[model samples]
Target chain A: MVHAESSTFAEGLTKEEVYTQVLEQASALLEGERNWVCNLSNASSLLYHALLSLPRPSSGVNWCGFYVVDTINPSQLILGPFQGHVACQQIPLGKGVCGTAAKEGKTQVVEDVEKFPGHIACDSRSKSEIVVPILQAGKVVAIIDIDCAELAGFDEVDQKHLEGFARIIAEGSDF
Target chain B: MVHAESSTFAEGLTKEEVYTQVLEQASALLEGERNWVCNLSNASSLLYHALLSLPRPSSGVNWCGFYVVDTINPSQLILGPFQGHVACQQIPLGKGVCGTAAKEGKTQVVEDVEKFPGHIACDSRSKSEIVVPILQAGKVVAIIDIDCAELAGFDEVDQKHLEGFARIIAEGSDF
Candidate 1:
């Protein structure tokens, strides 16, 4: 009967501190849960609420979720668990930001999504986005995708911490 | 690029009308998507935001999500996509409201969760709940679980509409 604790951040916590707390919370939440569906579902909720608890640019987060490699179609990434409005159902590898992250097996942090060629507009309000590849054995199994309503909403700090967050997910779940 | 449409309801729309619109929207959102992960992920978002657009008791919804029959462990239900606080990762058959719905292959609408025998409280804020079993070929495959903050939050209307909602999900996806 593990219930989801409401997200509440202490005042004056820096962005790094918040992410650190979020990653710790995610680890605790996913403990003893090896099912990727269950782990990713709760992780997305935790991350989305954590971002909402932050201040300014970070608080502008509009979407936070996952896109996992489709088992039926290996070349595409199907929408996984997410906490946001509805979203794109499928993204071909090497196409959108999420796909590129999976294809290149690296992180993609776009300060302005409009400047990225072939950028997919899943939500019109999203001006910036960050996609982190969740790699296992040097191959991407999924990606952590976040969108912000303001330009330059994500930076190196996000890339670093989110990559750590992705590692936690990869290790904690049997993907 | 199919972006999630922000949920909006016309002023004075009846609950049935809202449910009708939600079902239609869900059908449209799930079109051509047979993957259960993609379907359930978006379905939960659509349902959660749709309930938020309603007034009063309906608007008090605190949790709206799903739990599918575990692929590895057939006797338990692993949490599926959802839009709410984190929830129980797994529930044994016939152990909770969701389990009862799946075990009996029927709907369970508890007016007060405290009174339900062996109720599993995944969110303390949930005062009432409704669990609708998603059946495919007379076997339960998944469930539609919704929780509200007030007692008797769900009634016949919710059961009817949510059952319709569940059917839409079952037919649209390859669970």
Candidate 2:
């Protein structure tokens, strides 16, 4: 019988502790399932709910999802599995935060989206954002995009953990 | 500039009216975007949020998502874009509510999931479900699955509207 597993973080855990749990859980979830779609879909849910389980700042996350490199148009990134509001369907490389991350093949952590030049406002309420490029064999395959309603919602802790998360996705999935 | 569009239903709309709006909005969101992943991602968010915007029974929705026929394993359905907790990664054709719809290429509206044999409980809180197969070229390509927390959450109206929603997805996406 198939069972529904809870993705919530345990009570009283620090943000780093919660993220540690998340990375472990994500690895376990992706163990034998190398399908990129499945892994990414579940990973987003796991990350979204884990963030929501925390108090402010982290809990201020309004959007958590992905944008994958378009197969037909290599210079663009298409929307992928997400746990948030409807978003832009396509973003070209080097255009916005997501596009910049994909084009530069590096993580873009914007303390204030308004301060970032060419930041694409996919969600008007998103004051801060983080985009982690998932690279495989030195090529950008996809990106993990997180939007927060609070300013400076993401810091180095998030950068380090999310980069680790991206590595897990890169090594776990077939993409 | 990429702008985030709201998918919320207008206030005080009846259930049928809300569904009508959902169908129209889904079409507009899907216009010119034939990618199945992007379309399904947005469609699931649209439907899930639309349902949540309504009053109880409708607002009791616990999950809404899609499962496409596996490209590698023809008889299995792989998890697709969704708006809910994490779900089962795979369901063999003819095994559960989602699988049955995929295998039969028909809609399955179960008033009480517990009463249905071979029901796979991806979410234990799901008391009811409606699964509509998206058929293309006379074969099943994907399924739109919705789960509700209330018993008998789905009726003929839901079946009809969701079938229409399935048709829109079938015709709009490349699969």
True lDDT of residue A168, candidate 1:
93
**What would the TM-score be for candidate 1 when compared with the true structure?**
0.96
Worst lDDT window (10 residues) for model 2 chain B? B1-10
How accurate locally, in lDDT, is each candidate?
Answer: 0.89, 0.89
Q: TM-scores, in order shown?
A: 0.96, 0.97
Tens digit per residue, CA lDDT, model 2, A20-134: 9989888888887899988888899999988888888989998899999999989899999998888899999998899999999999999999999887888889999999999
| Candidate 2: TM-score, chain B only | 0.96
- Candidate 2 docks with a DockQ of 0.67
For B41-135, candidate 2 gives per-residue lDDT tens digits of: 88888899889988888899988999999999998999999988888999999988999999999899999999989989888899999999999
* Candidate 2: residue pairs that collide: none
Q: Taking the true A–B contacts (Cα pairs closer than 8 Å), what share appears in each candidate?
A: 0.77, 0.72
> Model 1: how many Å of interface RMSD?
1.8
Mark the regions of model 2 whose C-alpha exceeds 4 Å error after superposition: A1-3, B1-3
